[model samples]
Target: MNEDTYNEMNQLHESGGAVATVDQLIQTLRDDKNYDRLFDALLLKKRLEMGVPVVRPTSFDNLPEDRRAEFEEHYVNAAREIGSLHLEAGSIPRAWIYLRTIREPEPIVAAINALEISQDVDEELVDIALYQGVAPAKGLEMLLASHGTCNSITVLDQQFMQLEPQVRQECAALLAQTIYRDLTATIKYEVERKQGSAPTEETLRELITGREWLFAEDNYHIDVSHLHAVIRFCRSLDANRDEVRLATELTEYGAQLSPQYRYAGDPPFEDYYTAHHHFFNALTDTDRDAALDYFRDQLAGDAPDSDKQLTAYHLVDLLRRIDRTEDALDIAAKYLLSVEDQLEFSFAELCAETGRYDKLMEVSRAQHDPVGYAAALVEQARTP
Candidate 1:
């Protein structure tokens, strides 16, 4: 048997409480089917793993009755294994094959169930199965059982609101986990479907206007993209007034849901900045000032240097934007001497942009060792 078949049988047996030796699994596949069926299953599994959709061949219907029955059994068995081993993140290939290769309805139902049980499976694999139109209602129940948590549901409801009310059915919660994955996967799929363009009004509306999740976790992770999609969806629905309100709510809820993952001060600064950029951008001038004041006040207590640098940059930009060039220079100076070359360059550009050429020249010269500083100043003066 091929590695794909070996892996599938292993996962199936493992999930069913009958762990089989790999050699034993291989021997079983070899004796159980025609070489062509075995070859097709392996090929379909590979296609699914590569994220390529595999349409079922009509040839499956043309197989002899006994062979067709063999294929059906293999497909259902594969689906159950996919679901059972999915909790361990090991059943994606088999699951995809069941969806793409198995045409029999019973096997498709089994595949969908497997996907639901294996809630933590790849978003891409789930997406393939969903697009194939296999047992959606049952599949969703399985998704919720494996993935839905208070946090995950919150994200799901947010995305669901973006859909037509008719399409936004509550995910069933039969198993312990709640699968909000349909909406989450839908968001990712739509983004890919649109090739990174902003979502249309129809798509945007599908994403926003819900009080429940407006934020959700897919699989076992709280993806930042989910937050951003919600933010974008809100803005698209009402960029003028709703932007601020939606942003504020998201900020509040994000903090409440994961204080350690605070929307205001998340580290690796860029992501936090991106997540909350709309809130800051949507603020009235006075509101912006008040918000910055709050953020600046928080920075006084053992804040990371990354946060300080981002705060300093924001302050410098705000000051320069309002013609407080001198203040901007002061803010930039606080971080300029300590940051790396890229930020040093940014500060220098800000100084130039704000007509603080004298300060720019000074900082540039002063940045190096005394000898290098003197050499830089001489070079600057010599530039004319």
Candidate 2:
């Protein structure tokens, strides 16, 4: 039978406890003789292992104790058969699954045997440690003894997080002893801490100067607030080359991001806008123009109204910087009409810079903003 049919049969057996589903699976096993019998045996073994209730008019409770014991023996035998078949087929993933169904030390021993033959044991070991209740400390010990690399460290980190708090504390020293200690372990630990738990000063220093900070690629799954905290902490310290370079890269990245980008439970819109401004202000002329082009593209696209407004504001600033005052004033004039209250100060400032006192007075009157009106008046007086 195809994989979809097998999966559907399994799901039907699980949810409805249909005996017919099991019968069909058995019949398919018989008909497709050349197809790996191990797969068919594993399907039935998994169902029994999960304790799917038997669907029949008569219940198992009505059966004698000897009958129940016989059924239990059948399941154990089936699991063993499935394990042997999978091992013969060289399907370690399937073998591990069936082995885990058997009781304690068998699963552990089988996993070790699989590792002996398999070239890569990282994923298999992590799975066993996570699902089979294998001793993670022992797994770490074995991995370390083999002169494991970063993959082994990652496996240990995953297993560490899955461990109970007391067990994790017990294994902490083992993790510390691993030669391949890296940010993966630190990030895992930090992520589990209660939100807003401040990092130690030394931890902050390591995060900024460590390889993770300098060369880590962007990943959306990463907690941005952690990076933000790192940057903020670095700013609090004495300025250093690593800190300055990290800050600059992060700033450029922040600027290039579109206004449409959002995360769940983000900070206030004003904060995001302020960050964009800081990024744009820090860019070199060439990079700033590239950013300006991006903002212009966003303005021309079918962006949300709020995004358009933010883009227009940045576009105006870029134009002003590039000495395209007239273009800036023109965009400011049109943007000011609809967004007068928010853009009044900026529009008035632009007008004064370009000697458009008449336009500044118009904005000041329209918004009834004393600051813009006063600044415009001061510029008007200063004009020869």
Residues 164-230, candidate 2: write the lDDT tens digits: 6544543444443231133334543553463356444333234333324332344222234433332
Model 1 Cα shift for residue 57 (angstroms): 44
**lDDT (CA) per prediction:** 0.47, 0.51
Q: Report the Cα lDDT for residue 133, model 1.
A: 38
Off by over 4 Å in 1: 1-225, 228-246, 256-283, 304-307, 318-324, 364-384
Off by over 4 Å in 2: 1-223, 228-245, 251-282, 317-325, 358-382
Error of 1 at 156 (Å): 21
Give per-model TM-scores: 0.32, 0.30
**Tens-digit lDDT track for model 1 on 176-259?**
111123343554455555456655443233444442343344221345445543443332232234344435444443443444
RMSD of each: 18.8, 21.5
Candidate 2 scores a C-alpha RMSD against the true structure in Å of 21.5
For candidate 1, the lDDT comes to 0.47
